[model samples]
Target: MTQTLVKAPFRADQVGSLLRPESLKKAKNEYKAGKITAEQLHEVERQEIKRAVDKQIEAGLQVVTEGEFGRDWWHSTFMEHLLGAEGYIPEQGYNFSNQETDPYDVRLVDKVAYNPNHPFFQQAKELVEIVGDRAVVKFTIPSPNQFFHPNIINGQYKDFEEFAPDIIQAYKETIHEFYRIGIRYLQLDDVYLAVIATADFPPEEKKYLAELAVRVVNGVLEGKPEDLTVTTHVCRGNYRSDYSFSGGYDTVAPIVFANEKVDGFFLEYDDERSGSFEPLKYIPKGGPRVVLGLVTSKTGQLEDKEAIKARVQEATKYVPLEQLCLSPQCGFASTHHGNILTEEEQWEKLRFVVETANEIWE
Candidate 1:
């Protein structure tokens, strides 16, 4: 495997999706209400994305994303755009802490394929053009395993065996298209695998689920460009500052650490809910690195520099310091509604990650 030497998934990084500015938020709402033209919405998105990219650079981040401002939520937005999929706003919503979200869900209306003119591809292209070598432009998408959830998969295929190949091919084609468009850094935001890891099930069942997740991910990564830095972010589900699952990497570590073919693992470890660093021992001495998320995005309060340092030191006990990096537990805004913090607070948290990373890795 050839390593891509980009300053991303670096000693300092994030899980993409930043809080949408008020202007962008308003424009999105207006477009939804049919008050604004698609052309008008596109113009606003372009300007806002440019500003978001500039903010990443200003904050001392070497890697940047479009901040996912073009979409309302992470997973469904991308899924709905797939060639064979159609989305719907359900009457009810999923629960998370004190909140419930009226999420849009996707169903396969036909066989899936990459639509070259998909809005996300166009948006990613624009992001690459705007960054213009100023920083490494990163694009994030939901992992293929994510679509395997019963909510998405049940009606589409007879079983995993039947569904896997089509989705895997779609993702492979998508990755190749992304590479063709000058995208060298890509992150797969996969919250489902982490959720599966935390579930209480028969040992055999857990192992089976874990293995299937790894299989689909590795399949999606098949034949990827050696110079492309493909990483997976295992989210425990971040919506309105609440999580859907909680557990250590222990259950899935052995499977993912040993089996998955990727460049790095962006593992969440911001609080006690995620459990211990013991699973890091499964990581091989070399190859994929670990980007530890010790900072919190759920709240705006700055973490003590000394405390974070202590955690980094503790993590070094499992994985060598050279193979480690830092980030917030998750994105500040996994959805466009934004997290429960002020914009200034969001920047402060990210800036702190940069400052803390510099102190340790400098």
Candidate 2:
């Protein structure tokens, strides 16, 4: 039987979030210090995001993000905006590969539910209006599992199962709201699942954790709109270009690829740490498309186009070439501080992805 090809937003896409420009950074700091009003900060963001969107179009990407300028951190911004959540600083940092993150977390203070006026939703609306016909827009949020990170203690529930239902409901409502407001593309940036995937747990323990991750995500995705294109971006970790985990998708592929009801996947494959493309075999002949993260956002070094194409060809051994696309291994700026690369360098990397995809897939 012939396998039908999976259509995606673009042959060349990104994992969302671009490096924050100096102007946006300054405005954010000003707003935080009360030196500028919210209106003033938003004005800056509006202008900066316009520029970012233009840059993405110029790089030949069909789908672009607002660069997540309104966010201080990837997950914290959206989580903190939840109606029942509150933010707090912790005593220790989230240890990563060779570095540690500053302490920050969002706790459940009330019953979990969606906030009608989520700032991220408003930002997505602005981006689509600004982008017009130039390109499609995607808004990314950390997964619901992020709220239950072990480091975070729930203030309202004694156990995760006690509140998983509310969490699922809140996310479902949130997704529906985005669709109602005209958002067709949404990406959930999740490191928790990847962390579980890479951890060296016993076989049974690992499968159990992976299954739990899938259940929570699928719960959030339950009854999603058909027109909505939802995808998940898995990363080992990305904080100021530092990572927390390593290993391949082999362990979690069966759990995620077969269970989670996402339209596609943005997978990390930039370095040796991510293992091989062998696990692509488990993707099921005609399931979700896979976006190869052959380009790295952690550094400014440009990858050879021929090398990237060759790697994509290698991946085709498991999954058909038509089922594959290309993107950066992760966002250039998972946090507002941005990665270790310069803005120009980041643009170069994106341009490379575009050029490589054009040469291979177009």
RMSD of each: 2.6, 2.8
Error of 2 at 28 (Å): 1.5
lDDT of 1 by residue, 1-362 (tens): 11133545688888898999999889988999999999999999999889888888888888899989888888888998888887887777766757787656777777677777677888888889999989888899999887876667647677777888888998998999898888999999998788778888898988988899899999988889888999999998788788878778898899988788888899888889888999989888876889998998988889999999999999988899888888998898888877799888988888888888888887
TM-score for candidate 1, please give it. 0.96
Candidate 2's residue-wise lDDT over 1-362, tens digit each?
Answer: 11122335467889988999998888888889999999999999999999999999888788888988888889988998888888889787689878778888777778878898888888888988999877778888898878765445465877767777888999999999888878888998888878788888899978877787788889998899887998988878889999888888888887888778888988999999999998878787777889999999999999988999999999999998877889999999888878999999999999888888888876
Instruction: Report the number of the highest-TM-score candidate.
Output: 1
